[model samples]
Target: MSISSSGFSWPLRVYYEDTDVSGVVYHANYLKFFERARTEWLRSLGYSQESLRHEVEVAFTVSRVEVAFRSPARLDDQLIATVAVTELKRASLVMTQQLRLGDIDGRLLAEAEVKVVSVDAASFKPCALPDGFRNRVQTVENAASRNPSSSAA
Candidate 1:
């Protein structure tokens, strides 16, 4: 995994389980890749879902997802999944995520806009995200704005 001013990136290999009989990745599996990238993005800022649930009683849930499949990835292919916060609100944040082949700047296989909400872990009611978490993401965005070269798709 790598962190940059643009966003958080996680490296992954396309396993047999992620692909179809034809060896191309399943459409639904793109969502899983995006989800993992977001989880790691949170971890990069020192927040884990487990810790958040235990300490703050909050967990993130995907409220909406819009995905565009540009190309196909085959089994055993190396990929990079990226997560960048595009918008933030009191209880929800929109992340722009992408799946690329081989490296961060490689061929774009898929891209998605995912809206995630902070919710009460047990009750599953919407809740505001912690100030620290919001601030950390904002800091990253600020840096990205200053250095546009590391832009994420």
Candidate 2:
């Protein structure tokens, strides 16, 4: 529910369905949380996935993900999911995302480095990111990098 030069932070509450039998968040749900955060980040910049596909004829697909689980997030836990673009290329981008307990600087439950590729929505073939989107991302990334206090952890 906050934004900094570091990234966009989205607050979420753990639901029973997001947990395993032991009440800990299921491993796969972390991916979902990351995805949602990324989506919201794009939305914050005025681009929705749907519009990107239909208007720009581009779609972003996850090409790789490397996650490190530091601690467990249990049911009813208030969490904050963060999305920060680390690297941006013509056809792809890399992001560092984290699930933290309570706040942006709270306990890190899990962190992921994700790479996403832009592709032709209809053919699903690799393609360069649309110019407008790319430009906007560059603006955000540049601003974040300039703000020393908002450096990623």
Candidate 3:
């Protein structure tokens, strides 16, 4: 997770179905938001679950997750999911994800440290990240690398 790219920033609007009777977004829904951000981030990286299988011969699966709830999101509240790669390994990547509430961005609604493991598509077993992909992600950490600005999550 050493590489940090403004990876993706996706806006999410709270809806009625995402909340409970109290009109506050449910905690579990934060995971859904994180998942969407990660999926899109991967897509932006020119990788997709299906394409990764057919082309790269690999797919990613959740290996670990640790989340902390900080606040509640209310219905109609516009939120932002910011994702960044914080660590990387031969066969896994660690991501730091945050769900910020509204424009104020005062308090985090939720935060997660997620670990994704690369696996061989055919065996569905752990595998090292392909050289091409690994090198591309590593370039972000280079001293002369051009950092991409905040992205649409």
Candidate 4:
């Protein structure tokens, strides 16, 4: 994992199960990779999705996503998925994620802009994020701002 002014990056290796018969990554699998990166980003901020639901009665659900595939990644390829918060609203967050080859200067494979809403665990109704969670997000946002080179996808 690597953290930059741009966002949180999680390393991934394309596996056999992640590929198609031709060994190219299946299109839908990119969503799974991006989702994992987002979850890990939340974990890095000292919050776990399961714990949030159990303790705070809150959970995040994807509300919208727009993805563009630039290239196909093959099985065994080293990859990095980066998640950056582009907007933080009371009940939702908009993020941009990029999947790239793990090289000196990563090669872009796919990019997506996703929106996720915080909702009541039981009711599944939109809800404002907890104060502490908001603060954590702000902290990361502030840090990213300090590193101007970190650009969103």
Candidate 5:
């Protein structure tokens, strides 16, 4: 299994469409926000699910998602979504994710534990991660080792 990364963060801003009638972000909208962060995290590594499918004929799918609501995020609030690997198998990965409020001292907003499985595009069956994919993700681990917080400190 791959070890935990110190953590990766993606900045976001809560928009009007993301909220409910009460002005707080709907519970489920966080999932979309989280997904975007993860996807961007992968993009930062120079890979994308779409490219992974078109170029490598493989894609990642959410096998399971477990969310824990810790706090509310309101419209216009800047937030940060985090992604960190907790475990990795040949064909699946477990990630510990969190959403934190920005501008107010990095407060915890919500958290989730998500598991993803890689599958072949043609057959939609589980598949081992291609060498490139594994290597790219491993880059995150190495960077975390060098700078866990993604800061020069």
Candidate 6:
């Protein structure tokens, strides 16, 4: 399987618990996969959700999501969830994610545009992203540029 050059990719396997009775991955499970990828992306940059909340007193919450299911994934399928930062603002970020069949030449299965907002961990109110956090993201973006791939249709 080819790696996504435009973003971080997290590999996953469709397990029985992730599928419906018909053996197809349940639609809601795609959200979980996407979440995991995003979390891993943060970890790759030396951050964790907990650390962001505790150390920086900031947390990220999903503000919006727009998803399109182009195909279904069945049980035992190898999937790759790709996460890319499309836009970054003071208090929010727009990310594009894709779920693809990893072993099948990255055939697209589902895609989503997600907006995540930075907030005060205790108050849960909108807050500016930390400067270091933004810098790290910029670093990742720069690295991804070397092997850029379109996240758009």
Candidate 3 vs candidate 5, TM-score winner: 5
- In order, the Cα lDDT scores of the candidates are 0.85, 0.86, 0.81, 0.88, 0.86, 0.87
Off by over 4 Å in 6: 1-5, 148-153
Best by lDDT: 4
Instruction: Give the least accurate 10-residue stretch of model 6, judged by summed lDDT.
Output: 144-153
Sort every candidate by TM-score, greatest first: 5, 4, 6, 2, 1, 3
Best by TM-score: 5
Which residue pairs does candidate 3 place in steric collision? 1-86, 1-87, 1-88, 2-86, 2-87, 8-153, 9-152, 9-153, 10-153
Let me know the TM-score candidate 2 reaches against the reference structure: 0.90
Q: List, residue by residue over 1-153, the lDDT tens digit for candidate 4.
A: 122257888999999999999999999999999999999899888899999999999999999999999999999999999988888888888988999999786889999999999999999999999999988888876687688664333
Model 4 has an lDDT value of 0.88
lDDT of 1 by residue, 1-153 (tens): 122346678888999999998889999999999888888888877889999999989999999999999999999999999887778889988888889997555999999988999999999999998888888888877787678665443
lDDT per residue as tens, model 3, 1-153: 467556667788898999988889888888998998888777766777788889989999998999998888899999888777888899999988988875874468899999999999999899999988888666643322245653544
What's the CA error at residue 104 for candidate 6, in Å? 3.6
lDDT of 2 by residue, 1-153 (tens): 112347778888899999999999999999998998899889877899999999989999999999999999999999989888888888998988999998555999999999999999999999998888988887876777678555332
- The root-mean-square deviation over C-alpha atoms between each candidate and the true structure, in angstroms, is 4.1, 4.2, 2.5, 4.1, 2.0, 4.8
Worst 10 residues of 2 by lDDT: 1-10
TM-score per candidate, chains pooled: 0.90, 0.90, 0.86, 0.92, 0.93, 0.91
Clashing pairs in 1: none
RMSD after Cα superposition, model 2: 4.2
Indicate the residue-level lDDT of 116 in model 3: 93
